[model samples]
Target chain A: MTLRANNIEHFYGSEHILHNISLEIMPKKITAIIGESGSGKTTLLAILSSLLKPTRGTIYYDDILLSNIKNIDLFRKKNIGFVFQFHYLIDYLTLKENIALGALKESDNIEELIKTLGISNLANRYGNEVSGGERQRAAIARALVNSPSFVFADEPTGNLDTKNAIGVFELFRNFKDTSFIVATHDKKIIDYADIIIEMEDGYVKNISSQRT
Target chain B: MITPLKALRKNKFKTALIFFSMVVAISAIFLISAISNGIVGMYSTMLKTDGDIIVTQRGIADTFFSDINYTIKKRIEKISNVKEVNALILGAAPVDNLPIVGIYGVSENRFDSYKLISGIYPKSNEVIMGQKIYKMLNSPKKIVISKKEFNVSGVFKSKIGFEDGGVVMRLDDGSKIFHKSTSIFLVSLKDIESKNTITDINHLNSDIEAKTTDNFIDNYNQFKIIKTSSDVISALAFLMGVLGIVSMMSMVVNDRKVEFGIMRSVGLPSKTIIIKLVAETIIIAIFAYIFALALSYIVLEIIQNTQKFQGYINGEITFSLGALIFFTSVLMAIVGTLLPAIWASRVDPMSLILRGAY
Candidate 1:
């Protein structure tokens, strides 16, 4: 059982944003939706992530439809996680507390996860005291805290410098068993995806699969 | 709760700005209400100091304008439990640069109620001025009332504001000048039938009201007017305070839209967002109420010391009024956050990213 989007169409007050989108998200794989600004890639990611409902379509999580879930927030809490371009960490909270904010339930693996992300020491500092790369790493830790089945990221490395941008993609590469649907304009993201979805002007221009 | 508190702590300047606004607005509300209550209180105390049951014409806004025919005093004097009925006339006139001077016209027998500090009791057209008023006039030998000249015979002292800064004259002389009215009758209640005295006097005439000195302000028409106006203004002041809080809290929520978007994306429920906003706003309101209470005391002090309100209105310091302010402040905080919370919780995470919030 996996996620599927069927006959998805979206409009912004008569301005079409997405067109007849149908796709299946593979389990335990990295999928990149890459396009230029205004290409509607982020909107598609929003629809897939439960942050939005398409104008004409149904999203299915395995055998259950998204609409039938009744409590979208509860469903999202149980199975989904998200990271945005800017690491909107609450500045007053320490990085560790910020990560703990996303926990669906208490888990003993948090310390190990922080170590894996290479931010174990940085976790105790306030969010404002940390460097950009450190804060983004904390954001990533926050997203994975729940051990969700799907992690949706919208331009996760958009605010980073060149070195830190590469580091973010490397972090995604290390999480092979977690399904990631990342939307971005960065060409560097191409190397890390098991499947690449190319969007152009509210349409999917191409979808390519590469095991390598 | 910790998250909300931490958020407020981090935005120190903004939180302080919110607190200051609430304090000022709530203080204004407290002042208006207190002054109104105080004016009623001061007048009641002053009017009741030397009298037991006071009688005045019904529907008269001012005691000076209340007309109970001179002959009515005879009927009240005959009532059971009535020891003495003093005919007192109250009026105001301008003297020199001073705009308002209180004038009391009392019969010869009631002269003892006012202590004569110097000289003799007023004779015929002569008048005695209050020590405070005498000093302000630089010891004038004569004062004018209703454009009539009268000699100032002596200086007197009184605790009541009406008499402390006023003139006292013979009842006959006052009637000749003020004309066409008898202001009030002060009834001295005998111990045994004091309760029935007021009821007996009120039954004599439908045009006049008779109440114990303690309940005089409650029945006075002028006091009713003051009370009604203060209620309206206080309500408006509180509304403005609530609106101020709403505007400030809404802007705070707007500034955190990016953070709220992220919280929503991470599957934080709308309920949690509401709780945070409620917690933060209520905390601010509580602090504001405390500050406003202190500020109100200072404001009342300044008003009391000022020449304009010095003798008349002293702000009523009551536990019930303080409690009223506290409850209203909490209500203001809750109502102020309601809209912002809903808006924050419903924020579109995708729209925020596209709009450059994240």
Candidate 2:
């Protein structure tokens, strides 16, 4: 539940993406990782969420280091979920089936989840057939289907208007037991997050806490 | 696995192309291999006769062209363990417009192998036409060989391709027409287990060679060449099949790298992804192979019915041959899917997202 990164640095070829970055994400709390374009927010999110291994340093879920866990995919399958800026749903799959892909068991309540995401009428529709806002909501539903402890979102609202963007953030707040790490450039996230980690040029410039 | 099938169904065009490629590859392999198997089967059936050993003159490329004194049969009969000696005169003579009709001349008692369908065995100066050749030539009352006319006394059928496609006559008539002492001497041993009799008979004359029918069929230069060619051709066809699958699967996986990346990000294990791809390939491969089998059967039926291939082959795919084809096809399918799955698994998951659909 508590996610920790220690001196995580990454590079793509000769270019450095993230400097020595370290942070702790509290359990059941909303954490926002904010930075300008090309500031390495997505890269850091990628490393922490097990999408990519860091070039240097470590990430830990509670006390267990990432390298110590043998099957990373299975580990992620059970405890972690991911949502991307593009609402990366398989175009060939129906909306309900796409969400069910993340479900680890038959008892994950797919119908209720679809209703919660307010995509019940579009459950049988192909991923490509839904509106952008509805697709993002379905994406969020997918990330929560397995009741994973942590859900990582990278620019989930980049293409959305103010109302849709707010709707997306509201879903994150409503999912009570699931911790969310959102990497974005949106200023609106600051009002909803319990912790704010602002990044500049791949370095963690500031870490602030705000709770209602 | 079900999701992958759904995906294939969704992209029906791509799936169909892969399916067609697989079908063509498998069908080509089975059809060519069947021809190869047919040659061996034909020879084996032809040689299953009462005579256990064959004696022909040394240094001959064409077995029927070999010549030795017919009197050598008496000397060979006198050898220890030699039960009987039968002299045979063999040659090829053109009939009507058909070139190279095989001709067989045997001693009086050697006609048991022929199934007499319509008439008795041939007498001196007379000929019994093979059933197929008789019907094919429209049942002529007389035929010509070496400018000599012989009355067609009866019709007989022998499943052996060379015999069924030609004519049989008495040894005296054949010797006079062919102008040779004899082409071959077939020997039957008292005890078939007596292997030394062949060597002893071989030493009797310097100009002639004797070998057991099994040894001759296996070691004959021409038969060896056919076997080797069949093996090489079948192996090459299977290799090309594997390569075709590899190429098709490579394109499929390459095109879906982003999709795989998303799947991985959603926590689908690389092993599961691999299993799915292999499963999909096997389904297509099995279906294609079954379809190819049906196609091959239709082609074989046409060959069996056609005038060109009658008596040459039975147009059969044996049990072992079918199983060999099936296993090779499945192996090709698995190998083809595995390579691409491995490449997809190693691809950076987030890189696909950042660089692709994002």
lDDT of 1 by residue, B1-358 (tens): 6787889998888799888888887888789888888878767765775578888887677777887877898998888678888898877777666788877788887898788899889999899987777877788998877778899899888765557678899998888867745789888877734677888898999999887876776767788898889888878877887788788888888777776777777778888888888889899999999888898899888865566542555688699989988898888888878887887787676665454363
Of the true interface contacts, what fraction does each candidate have? Answer: 0.73, 0.62
What does candidate 1's lDDT look like per residue over A23-65, in tens digits? 9998888899999999998889999999887899999989889
User: What does candidate 2 score on TM?
Assistant: 0.87
Per-prediction TM-score, chain A only? 0.94, 0.97
For model 2, residues A32-121, the per-residue Cα lDDT tens digits are 999999999999988999989899999999999988898888788788889988888888898988888757865457888889889999
Q: Write the per-residue lDDT of candidate 2 for residues B8-93, one digit (tens) a residue.
A: 88767767877887888788878877876776666655554656888889877656779998888888888889888777787888
On a 0 to 100 scale, what is the lDDT of residue A160 in model 1?
Answer: 92
- Candidate 1, A132: how far from true, in Å? 1.6
Q: TM-scores of all models? A: 0.87, 0.87
Candidate 1 lDDT (Cα, 0 to 1): 0.82
Question: Once superposed on the true structure, which residue ranges of model 2 sit more than 4 Å away at CA?
Answer: A91-93, A105-112, A119-125, A128-134, A159-164, A186-190, B57-62, B65-69, B72-90, B116-120, B124-159, B173-179, B184-212, B305-314, B352-358
